[model samples]
Target chain A: MPYPKVDVDEWRLSVKGCVEEPLHLTYNDLLRLPQITQSVTLECAGNKRALRDPKTRGEQFLLGAISNAVWTGVPLQTILYLAGIRPEAQEIVFQGMDVGFRTDIPDLLSYSRSLPVTKAIHPDTLLALFMNYEPLPAKHGFPVRLVVPGWYAMGSVKWLRRILVIEHPFDGPYQSRDYVLYTRPDDYAHGVPITEIQVNSSIAYPTDQQTVRRGNQYVYGIAWSGSNNVTEIDISTDGGHIWQPADWIDSEQRYTWRRWSFHWKADLPGEYMIMSRASDESGAVQRQQALWNVKGYVNNSIHQVKVYVE
Target chain B: MPYPKVDVDEWRLSVKGCVEEPLHLTYNDLLRLPQITQSVTLECAGNKRALRDPKTRGEQFLLGAISNAVWTGVPLQTILYLAGIRPEAQEIVFQGMDVGFRTDIPDLLSYSRSLPVTKAIHPDTLLALFMNYEPLPAKHGFPVRLVVPGWYAMGSVKWLRRILVIEHPFDGPYQSRDYVLYTRPDDYAHGVPITEIQVNSSIAYPTDQQTVRRGNQYVYGIAWSGSNNVTEIDISTDGGHIWQPADWIDSEQRYTWRRWSFHWKADLPGEYMIMSRASDESGAVQRQQALWNVKGYVNNSIHQVKVYVE
Candidate 1:
């Protein structure tokens, strides 16, 4: 069904869910409301898992979907409060505009995600309407969207249309279909619904297979853990035998990656190696090998690369 | 002084801090060592800060030095084995090839930073010598750098030269001079050293004051916080009275901005206002009022823009 021919200036965002008075937000209504801003590290729910094979190619990025951008919108809870929600509303749902292959289901469907009413009403959550001070692009969801910070990108639905307050989880692929993790075969694939992403690190510079000489080389890279920023990063040149530590650039919070570097000299010429590891606020460290899944969602395996030393 | 030009293929990182053995590494040797890749978020020590007023454009962004990149290097500990230093080497000092800065300071001074010896052996650290699957760019410090996961950007020194295991912090401008807060006076009279960034956000698209049309306008922007990953964003249409949440795009780390949108309707004809705010992983959010400081390192104020309603 055709949504409407309304202009964005007079657009009204209807807020209906576990609230008090289903509220309708106008363009001015949104702009006039108090504003909020924060620095967040966003990673695609399916970021960087394709580089495992030698044939992988693109921007040379490891299946990248992680990027940082500023977002503006309204507090979802503020609208929920105005909307007058019923006590039975235990969940909050968001729907987006993109339609892609999402499992055995043939026809494409809009992206959608739902969270417990508790997580939904948190002040940190927003009903996103603007990106980088501009209107949304067609490819990036033009009309409306939901901003759930610290959660997987899946939950922040784009091209959002309606929000429903329910008691159980939604029947969309986001909840029951794709994001679930089953530890054991019979252990029930139903794992903790993906909400906040795990703390992770990456070697941004000096990717695998780089060539180097026997001289001076400074090592550098980034590290971050979704809800919990990076607290530490370690480097190993002799295959983990000896270690060195660089410096931390920021000390605000441990949820973001802090830049670090180490300067070293190579006396003899031969095949050399390089490696870096990181840990987050919760003390979760990057493991040597990440648990493999059919669809590589959280491939937090120890990332290793080879460089030719002549 | 010009440092040695090492061949990328024959380089090996040597870590010789307080470790048991001063290990030696080769380029390939570093790769062969236990390697890990993580999608961590990175935020510049000084990101998002503006001096109010139309003529108040000191610098549009204090948000440089912040970026999320994958790092591949040797664990710092393994390299320390090559030196077999005395246990008293409590400070891990790192120097980089990015020796000279555009500053008025005379002569070339390689950048440097240092950390506690304990952190040097931490497993998540790295002595990175390459960037983005390639050798470090000259602009980004060619030889090597340090990865300190969750600290400030200052710690990641570039164009490495030396690693001194000292008993005290290195006293240098590059290490303690640039990138600091401006508490000396309201206008950076005697700026202090900056250890971290503050909450910050921005509108990447339409930009400030850009006239937008009526119809389904996609509002867009980017947001970020210091070491915390942005977890929430809100938009205001009625000048802060009422607000609506937007759809927040997922990214690789907290340092990057989030792409978000909202569909505004311009059914009626008149002037309109727009604003945005961000919240981080630590639950710290941006306020509407901006603060004044010396260097304007961390300025996270509400971003405002205007549009017309049809």
Candidate 2:
């Protein structure tokens, strides 16, 4: 599939359904609103598909689908309030301008998502028009896009076009069926939406399969939680028996990954599985293995790299 | 500064204050209650003091302040129910058998914590009597201990002695003064109790400063978000420009650290900074720097390590 080509001049954002006053606004109208800027991170639901199987299926995202950027936009809450949301509205569906066929659905439909009304009205939710201070890129979502803070990239519907308020749970294929966790033995019947990103950490140096001479060295890596701050990172040179603390550098910026450094004295001449672990404020711990699921969503496990020392 | 020794035969856990029926129970009485086993992770508020400044001014913790084990205990809710908590009770204070003096307090006071009634009566809250299938050890908590799941280790007051149901927010030095986040510039006035363990991650292999030969290498680590699940881990071998995904090696287990691995092919001979980033279900992200506070609590930033390639 190719990225959608949208005519900015012809594009219009429409807010309809379950509102006393529906909205039909052009790009200029959105620009007229007082702009707010925020640095938000978006991660594809399948960022680690390879964790499920070395050979991935459907979409194989090898870390390219995740990024953080400063976004400029109008608060979605302002528009929701101006439209006069009906008290009866239970859901708010955002539809992207990009249309495509899906194997999960019987008919062609625009990429869309139905968010709980409460989530739709959150102050952080935005109808973003810019990425990194520039007009939203075509591939990213030009004209307008929904920037859902603290949620997976799927929640941030790019190339957004329609905002529909409805009275029932959105049972679209992505909502009720596709983007869910089948990690439970019962399968999809008891699955949950892959909403928030999980806590995870990884090593970036000594490129995998890189050999190192026996002497003093160091290991560098980054770690982040979806919305909460990372408290600590531990590094182990001896498989899993012992762990050493790593020091974080710089400021703890919200919605962004933090950097940490550890002094490693690689004194042995053998293959070593250098590992790192991360823990968040909410008490969630990374596992040694990915939770196997039908959809393979939210597979945050411990990160390890095998390195040789000679 | 040593663990208090208590004769289990004579120790009595008293349930008084704001209860319809004040009761006194001994060690044997607690064992009679239906036992439930749970695996919970406990972390000290100062788990990563070395991450701040190597020479810590206050209590220092390296990676050893955290552990997870199976606990056998009776639900705190059951005892609360039997005691008939008065509607006016707003706080539930767990007082440990150990008593000591603190700089903030005028007189000796038992190491204690005040929990909200709601949290005190949570189904998972327990008055644990055994750990890892064995009777609680003296250093860990002898006769009985309050085990508050999903909270920092301080909330699990050891060597339990008394349970006080009070009608107001407990204002003991530990509650209103110590354990609060002094990271804010203004200091203690706006501080918050260090309740839950902050999100954190660590590397377990390639002992710090260890030397490595140039060739193929693997990086490993573990991650956790207090009570939530980890979602993603990104690795960057070339500073921060490009990131590669690390594969989780095992199944996702609750209340435990996860393991992940990355494949690196180091073709050059030079120093490299390997890093990792993690995200959690609660949407918390690791920061680039620790959130500075007077007490330095909840500093979950990204982790990195330095290594030489020759």
Candidate 3:
């Protein structure tokens, strides 16, 4: 089901959690705060799962989220600060206008979640008023949405309307219910909580992706992760066993993808199996085989591409 | 030196790779092909290169490329089939009219790339004539471009005007001189090759990311990869040490993002780090840190998001 839609004027996010005085801000009201500028990434936690082939297939890269935009808004903590936190206030609840459809086990779903207070006051946390140098898109979240940087997209509440302080986690279908994980292979039981996106890579050229070889050429693509930042990415002209590292350009932001290039002489014509792999500081990297789960979560399989190198 | 802003009548891409006769396709002629439709992703080879922070304290998750659009145009191979291929034809090359600016290099950066004939003929690759149900935007390739599925945006040369075929890889600056991995920290002597983007994930919510308090709320985002299709994405309310899974809703296209949900109770309130990791059937998973290299290429590092548990 789609999130609840509202007229621009009817939209307002209420701040009642752990505060001295409750605060309510309308779409226009959010514009009044001392605007702060921040560049943040909001991503869909679930990425690549099924669909695979060294050649002739859909995109091998993960999906959803991973968008970066400039945000302008007021500090979330400032609002929380004004709403004097009660000593017992342990968490701040966030709710969105999106109401989900009815499910088999539950009556319906309303999108909402919560976080601890300390983070609410972080200097970077803001109620975003702008995106990509423009007002937010309705599809993205118009009016106001909670901005939580350096965190997964989940922290950002869209079509935001209500906020409250509570002593414990809110047991909603989405929170206490969804976003859990089953640790074991056969463990269909969802127990883990949902949050971070993992590091991985894909093959974009001579990509088993299967493209027409019209002439001599070049190839290009992107890579990224959340932990220590991208340090190295390599491509293999002769498949996974042998590989060569690629070049990178330095940048101011570390949460961005590092581009790479591989030279395919393509002089001696033959069928080639191209592949690429990425690794991070945590010593974690892509593998040849994929892990299995009932829901198919965290599929970080290596990428293999094929091309007729003329 | 942009591709000398050619008039639409003058803009055309020549199809010459391994074909019996070289076929030149004008803007109008290219648009005349059976208007095929497919949702494709255009990922900049170097998008989000600035941000990939897990250990460092910089904003990560800048989105570049990896864009989805419903494309319309002639299938690349359709034109190739008309031209007829030479059995010895080893590769297909694509040349573009877009030379937006001059790099430190001498020649204008007229985009160029190639695909083997087999992959180029795949049903999905299109000599794109339209985008998002509309004509091409000037900022984008106005006249025409190649739509190579499951590949980086670079290979889908924009403002395309030429298709060459050579026994060797297209030896243009972009072919090997450019877009190739030229350096690495540990192995400065040798560089990696460019091939594909690794399986990766990014934060799409909390777009203007910052810290947030934990409580009853819903966290949602997207994920994908170029190698394996996203199977499942895991979320971490804490930093990446532990992870939980989320739910995904099917959207229209394959390369497009599928909405996923994660509900957080936020019982623990403190400085909470939120992140997500994705995995694909090929076994490529996300990690907190990415491989460190000289010119960071394909930085598929784990996504780190900082939030506070109240």
Candidate 4:
């Protein structure tokens, strides 16, 4: 579905439910507040779907969908504080302006998700109004959007409309079911909510299966971790037989990926499986085998590419 | 030398000599005139200099010096028409605001170049004031710059201050001495001014000498011709013995390079030499051996990369 054609003058963001004093604000009201700008990278949860299986169930997006932009907005915590959250509030539900009927659910519903009150009031969580120093484009959420730093892009709800403070945990379909990771391949009996990003890396150059001449060559890619800074990236040329560290191209930035490069001298010819794995400061390393789920959520498995040396 | 910081308010571009009336225009005056915009690639004359022999004279620039941007300004033809060129005019000389002493000439000279009157009034030639939709950055020629599309960056002089019409051909050191191509390796006696770009292609991915794993791979790069649209890009994976056509990624854009990609299946693990050559619609093909020049101005020889698959 396309983004809702919202009338900025008529759009009123309501902060009700468990709030001590309910409040509704126009688009201009949000801009009047002190705004801070930050550069952040938002990666879709299923960014490497095509690599997992040639016929994945979801859109087979490559790494290009990810982008870093300067976002300017007011911190969600600032507004929550002004609304005077009730002591009983346990979660905050953010509803997007976009609405449609789900095949699985009979009733028409607006796309929404709920976050624990603690996560909602985090300083990094923002109600973003600008992107790349300009008013956000409609495709990227025009009037306002929610930005959850260090988390999967789904957490940063777009076309944000309502923020409801709930006294108990809110179990919306998107929050409790859709974005869940099924650790076992076959069954969906046990699952966990997908939150922070897994340690991940992808080769940006010498695109997948690139043919190269035999010689000393450089391999480079970008790596990132959701909740923690990427500590190191390792490249494997002999199907994990030997590993070497790739040099970091830039200093690590919080909530942003870092570029790395590795030099490899190919003395022999033939086919080689080149793979890159990333580890975060939190001791989280990309897994060789991703935990399969029907929805293909956080599949941060090691990224591999094949190349021919002629 | 750093960019000469010229006050925009004090700067006035003068069009004089061999004209019915001399014209003096401020920055605002240029913007007020009918404007045209185009996206053109500006490549330095010495781009890819490091690829040449180390003994080659002139600054060795790598690949980063080339950039493409949307330039908005009045066409040089429009301004020249307004000044009313005389039939006696043979050349149009452009002088930059920067002043420096040339050790060879032993005189303070504002860097300048002259184009034949016929070339000066070409519709694509622009007196650009804006780059990428924003006012040109100071380092990129702040108030105004001359943009000669499809020519080497030196032809697009920056920090432009004056345009002089001449009845005789220009013989400036830069035009006749520096940016000349020496056909013979050992002698500079037979030289010609470097004009339009040579048919060229460069590997943007799997950079120089990168190693990859054994498997299917895609080789892609950008190709462009100086005076005509790129027609075909051929890839040689077997040391230039076997050549294959790469698929064009997008429709051709005038004055812009086209991206092309090829699929290669790496079945053996070994070393290989990969090379790409471009051909233009004008029947100009990239040469296997570049013309040996003292300045290394147009080194559009076939680009080769050595990679090891293991």
DockQ-based class of model 1: incorrect
Off by over 4 Å in 3: A1-5, A52-65, A185-190, A211-219, A250-252, A264-268, A281-283, A289-291, B1-310
Write down the TM-score of every candidate: 0.47, 0.49, 0.50, 0.51
The lDDT values for all models are 0.62, 0.77, 0.65, 0.83
In candidate 3, clashing pairs total: 201
Cα misplacement distance, residue A199 of candidate 2 (Å) = 1.0
**Candidate 4 docking quality: incorrect, acceptable, medium or high:** incorrect
Q: Could you tell me the lDDT of residue B165 within candidate 1?
A: 76
DockQ (CA atoms), all models: 0.01, 0.01, 0.03, 0.02
lDDT-better candidate, 1 vs 3: 3
Model 1 alpha-carbon drift over 4 Å, by segment? A1-11, A51-63, A100-103, A106-108, A130-144, A184-189, B1-310
Candidate 3 lDDT (Cα, 0 to 1): 0.65
- Write the residue-wise lDDT of candidate 3 on A1-310 in tens digits: 5545678777667788556788877777767767888766555544553233221111223444357678888898877777788898888888888775522233455578777777777788878878877987876777778887655676688878899899876766666544555556446455666554455665545343243333455555456665346677787767777878766643424445555666655555555677667777667677776555433445556666566542
Candidate topping DockQ: 3
Model 2: chain A TM-score against the true structure: 0.93
Q: What is the TM-score of chain B alone in each candidate?
A: 0.77, 0.92, 0.86, 0.95
**Which ranking of candidates, highest lDDT first?**
4, 2, 3, 1
Candidate number with the higher DockQ (1 or 4): 4
